[model samples]
Target: MSAPETATPTIPDYAGDPNAVLNDTNAVWRHGGPPNYSNTRKNWEIAASFKSFLTDWRTVDPNKYTFVMNGGEPQSAEHMLRSNFYSPLNNDFESSHKTFKRMMPTFAWEVLEVYSGPPKVAFKWRHWGVMKNDYVGYNDKKQKVRVKAHGGPIDIQGVTVATVNGALKVEKLETWFDPLSMFKQVSKDNEVFIDEDSA
Candidate 1:
């Protein structure tokens, strides 16, 4: 008798959008490394698509997700969602809308590359955004301050790692970026003045 035929392994199609599979809770994300920036249009499209995928956070499980920056301490999904994602956009303390909306129009990302396997996906990308107004946040001294960009664009490179389970839900996500470079760009373009003492 001929040897038994084995089933062919099937690859999951990302449907021209990696975020489609990533939105599910079984997926996990981790940072691969820093990305390389380029001014090409193709790269910009990739970055924009990936950014769209990240806008939704309802599918991520807080207990299973984690984000790390520059090899520093890993932050939980809940913490990242509240502090980095949510707080920046809608701080109750701030009288006016800050960060996200202000930078939305100029915000862009260039996806340099993507690597994928079952239950795992990685994106290397460059992010760009211009400061339209003063970006209010805590300074190095933990004091409240406003950072201005003077209408200049700020660019940085980063990587995002993601993992998925059989259910195709995103379980974890980690992102990496250079804090110093981001700060330097903002400070270089506009003056940073103290707003108030950290409460």
Candidate 2:
């Protein structure tokens, strides 16, 4: 008996503009290795790396606005904390805003890139400060946002990939922002976690 023909899988079609925003090319290097990183050194190294990324992002495409995060919206870490999303104390809000908007931007927030993982899970709608700073609550007190990230093997062919809990709510830079549809689209595209072992 002849073996049945195996159908090649095509990338799942996401229902929106892949170019409409929410993305990047890649980062300089991957984060890993036992001897390569120590806790203190890793933190410092990552901070330095991120700073470098911000510098590059600013000059990358000057002809076009370099929006930082998914969909490249003009919003910043400061705007997010102060906005109705998370209610920070007015003074804290202003201070945080200044930190992200002014101080951070001074480092050229333009070149900042999202650290890679599952594109969908990694490409969230939240502001940069929320992701980078301490926004998520901790042991009953406020703390950094606790997001779950998985790594490795993935087939780059498809779009309907991964799932991020609050991804949809991220603002879009297009004609309109539809968090629900965008989330759905990403989910269907398989944009989330691609098992690093799946090569």
Candidate 3:
């Protein structure tokens, strides 16, 4: 029999709002084949929709939901933005968002596969976006770093392990990915922008 055809992935538009998109948004891998695939799709969509950036994608209980990124210590969603967004960039939430926004305008994400299910879920994912502009960031040393745009995609992969409450609302979320890999990509030239204020 001929191989079943798979539909091409269409990422979420976010329409300037997804906080959002490799986001192939299709991470779910389509449906109608297996029950597990459906479950996997549900979990992936739950993650993409309930992200801390903007639960705007889906309505989540204020008291029941929070997206926390774990590096060393767990922190609130807003705090995650303020923390080392890219390890080298140690700026406030707003500043970090602005810097990263300019770096990857269409940073998309998708699910690779699901390892387990229910209350506790584990999965692999991929995020990629084209570098349309330069990347500006602050290192832990409080130094300014700028990398010219390579006009290529800064692709990243990571794993998220989360626990859901009775309602399937993620109560605790944690993700692990190499932020330095992204840094190494944009910093291939090792170009550094001096801190003029220090002069």
Candidate 4:
């Protein structure tokens, strides 16, 4: 008996709109398929709205409201932007969004689980992408060698906590993920290996 041939997954085509790319089914993959939560899972539109806010922060008017992001770090009332740490100070949405876009130029989120509640909705998803441009630390090594690009597909799981108003706009979002693992993968793909023996 011959084995059945599996179909190859095609890269999503997004007509130049960065936010539209997330809607591509071919780009998203869930481990056990999509989870079936009570209210949130059944409400497909909520998921779509959540995803839209993620892919495009501008989807919501920033001048009208502020968004918050927490990366599982210690709680702080202030919002600050530092070179290190994903947990930027609250209220620095613009800088944070700019930083995020610069780091992950080409990316997609595969939603695995979602929980909708009053004033807040949370979802667990996988963030997958390729580093097409040089981003901060990762760029230093590539730029020194004059390399145009670095890093392969990055598949990492993360959880996002968001507050959505009645208007369906994301008022705040908090995310948690393993930064060490992400950086390690980027380092490997960029050929910026560290000598463990020397250390």
Candidate 5:
């Protein structure tokens, strides 16, 4: 008897708003960039996580999985990006609508309902930063107003924000990068979420 032909796992198609991508108007920019594939497992973790969220792809529960294990040995950067990063990004992009719904209760509920990209849960470690300038409702002392975003309290402790560069400047120091860090050693400083001013 012949074995049954198994179907290949496919990524879902998602559309994005041109303005949000080009201008970076989305709320996620407040934290930093979108979630990225840092390793093979993280990539798959995100893929599986989001796939579970999708109404259509919920049925895909593959028994056989691919991953590297306990040792410090690592996979090639390109391979890591291909397998891990793109998959979750693609999945989130498809379900941005639902993602926003899941996220809205956690953060400031007043901003635009539609989102341009993935949520901060999808944010790579690099996006975490300290605020440089004062953001309205972002700083409690100044405005004393609390707003929520992405299903979390924005003004809460340890919730990373773009830290003040000086008095008026808000900047993000890249503790992590997508392209270069993929292959090289992850800096000790990068590993620790220290003061945001240091780049």
Candidate 6:
């Protein structure tokens, strides 16, 4: 019998500008915030694009911008990427962003809602992507940690509180989220639970 030709599988194209998707995306506002604060679109845009702005931070005044996670002290983008995306000590800025970008080419972000306004803005945001390729990470020891591609959505959400100067610079930013939840999704067997009593 003659063999039939099989078509190659295609990767889904990532829509919109990868660096500026959050710009066209809106940050929904529901209601109350601190008094004396104006929850305007300008403020929302600032909060929404804060991460992107930080990414191209050569234009950012070092003396004016700061970032933190949860309630911890301020850190640079390098510190944040290394700590949050992959191994804190293993992957540097280039490798960490590149690794994740390749693994999750369609990563998208949006702000669910804005709770407050500038000078000190508080909002909830989402980071999501599809596993178009294998999820690979480096541990603190620089060993490779990988999970096969599942072609499923991976998501994480969190609240961000930041202070911006009159120039719209994010002076101090803090984000709180359950990182372990996000990590569990990329695990080889997500449902594999350890026996607590045995430990």
Task: State residue 91's C-alpha deviation in candidate 5, in Å.
Answer: 30
Order the candidate numbers by TM-score, best to worst. 6, 3, 1, 4, 2, 5
> In model 5, where is the ten-residue run with the lowest total lDDT?
134-143
TM-score: model 3 vs. ground truth: 0.61
Span of 10 residues, lowest total lDDT, candidate 3: 30-39
Question: What are the RMSDs of all candidates, in order?
Answer: 9.0, 18.6, 11.7, 15.7, 19.7, 19.5
TM-score of each: 0.56, 0.20, 0.61, 0.43, 0.18, 0.63
Write one digit per residue (lDDT tens) for candidate 4, span 127-181: 6788666443212122212122465666788787766655455555576666556
Model 6 TM: 0.63
Candidate 4 residue pairs in backbone clash:
79-89, 79-90, 80-89
| Candidate 5 lDDT tens digits, 132-195 | 2221111112212211222212231112222221121212211123433321222212321222
Which pairs, if any, clash in model 3?
21-108, 22-108, 22-109, 23-108, 23-109
Candidate 3 Cα deviation (angstroms), residue 86 = 5.9
- Residues 1-199 of candidate 1 have per-residue lDDT tens digits of 8999998854344333444433444423222221222432332123222333333333344356555666667665222223211233344322222354454345665678897654777889887887676666643344566665478777889887766655444566667766556667767844767745463
- Tens-place lDDT per residue, model 6, 31-98, is 22111222222333333333344433322345766667767777765334332225767766556666
Candidate 5 structure lDDT:
0.25
Stretches off by above 4 angstroms in model 5 are 14-127, 138-199
Q: Which ten residues in a row have the lowest lDDT in candidate 6?
A: 29-38
Alpha-carbon shift of residue 25 in model 6 (angstroms)? 24
Residues 54-113, candidate 2: write the lDDT tens digits.
332321222332223224455423222222112354335434444433322322111123
